[model samples]
Target: MAENKRDYYEVLGISKNADDAAIKKAYRVLAKKYHPDANPGDKNAEKMFKEASEAYAVLSDPEKRRQYDQFGHAAFEGGAGGSGGFGGFDFSSFEGADIFGDIFGDLFGGGRRHSGPSNGPIQGANVRTSVRLTFEEAIFGCEKEISINYKEECSTCHGSGAKPGTTPETCTKCNGKGKVMYTQQSFFGTVQNVQTCSACGGSGKVIKDKCSACRGSGYVIKKKTFKVKIPAGIDNGLSVRMAGGGEPGVNGGPRGDLLVSAVVSDHPIFKRQDINIFSTVPVSFTKAALGGKINIKTVDGEVEYEVKPGTQTDTKIRLKGKGVPSLRSSSLRGDHYVTLVVQVPTMMTPAQKEALRAYDEAMNAFTKNDEKTRKKGFFSK
Candidate 1:
């Protein structure tokens, strides 16, 4: 298998020294090109898509990439490097699903995590979407309503897929097991493959008089609105999961979850680092020399801050408990840091220049007197 497979870097059209971002970019481009949705019924394109996905599944991970670089494909070959082949590449892992979801959604409508017994109840598929929040809203927390289009159980047949007056019968091909077992010749002698019943599509039942509303699919595309509560201090790119807020499950299984990813807009005045808030305030040269109370904008509102006398440019002041509240613990809050920047006069009127000259002369005289005093001291002598 290793001898026949192409190199991961060669598949993605990248170098061995390619960074994570580069690999992701190359994968995205290739995935979009060879995606089944983009090239429907093209077997070659489908194979390429799976190949690229497999390559990305390994190279995108740091540990797997390290092993691959050290031992090549032999690292993943069974018993070749004393490691189980492809066992660590779990498709259900958050990293793997997140990377695959964006591309696979277009091909499969949405990604599905298959689990449970073959003939038993199965959990519904999860739904994914994104939400953009204002910086203030993310800091203070707010409720938002988002609309999503998803599949729901048909009302006419109540998810049975049978006609109103009729019911479904157990699939004869698999004897209601929903799967068929078969054996194939392999190097180890024989391998068993369990496949879904083609007659019933793994539903374990076949409907002769199908429901007109759902066309025997038991589900219909429906639009729904859900109110989402965004936690305070929820940062950008973080996802919020809503349990049992997805599609209806099969055979009485629990519904899936809804994952809403947040995109927090940047604030013009304030920048956030973890829970801390940072902002720069401009102060005049006179204010730096003779400091007084100044108005500063905070998340809550404008607040007055006192600058120490003789405060210099680039001076930083901290306001305790003025930053964002912690998402985990609302009682705990971070401090706000304000950096003061003293503005120098770029242009001056004639009167202002004359006043500055007089002030300079006064400062020169005071400095000279101080020097003479210091020189007269015994230590200086």
Candidate 2:
């Protein structure tokens, strides 16, 4: 038996100098891959699993590993190919062997299922949704209705999942504990595996006559309406949270929150930053050259602004407290910046074009006369 046995380190695919963590890490990979739960009814995988488990049982223990490294498999046997003594070594007697729980936890979803009821309160997940808002609605705040696909207990059966005249029966397979236990023999010892009751789908009670309204799920999906008060100054993609407006909670826990993301529509004449509003107002070339009142569109309304004389194109002007209202305080407001874009006429009547040409000639003649007058004044001085 000893002569036919392979080296412990080779079985686990580790080195002679491999640390405890490395040994456990290598064993975890093999165990997860070749475990009976993963590869069911596969004899080759089971054989590999047994080999790996035996290798881990020997190598994980410091004293056993030291003995194996010095004397090899013969250390566990009475003699070469002997059947007595270390040949029948029970690895379940290995010291501090709590790693099985951790390995099993990883194989399962974290916690090990025990042969008992585990129906407990767990918080529901949050629900996300989006709401479309106009640019001004987001700036000045507005109330909007949001539709939610919500779940609630059926009114006909009141979450029992049974008909109105019937009640649920206790699960016979798991004895109402919602779990079933079975034993699996491994190198260490008998590993008792617990699973959810297949008959009742882990629910302690089973409905004989199902509720027609809920189809035996104890809950029904319905369209729920919620009035969401969108805050002023809420920007696009920002969310508004409504408590208890999401999906129905399980096991009587509180319902999740409804997160509504604001999708603000773009305005035709305006753009916004954090708190400031920006807009480009087209001013006629004549109005820019000669100062005059122009109507500027703002979020509040159309306001009259005086264009400064000789105002260049793309000149920026500020309107105090004309931007978005503060979300925290309605009394506070941001400034609106207006860019005056001078608009030149692309086409002109023949008479208008001739008048422009005459004005240009007159200006050039006036410039020459002014220069001559300046030279004469200097000479006389």
Highest-scoring model, TM-score: 1
C-alpha lDDT of all candidate models, in order: 0.83, 0.82
Write the residue-wise lDDT of candidate 1 on 198-302 in tens digits: 998887899999999999988899888999999998999998999988877877788999999999999999999999999999998888888888999999899
Candidate 2 residue lDDT tens string, 107-134:
7766564433554454568899999999
lDDT of the structure predicted as candidate 2 = 0.82
Name the candidate that leads on lDDT. Answer: 1
- 141: Cα error in model 1, Å: 0.8
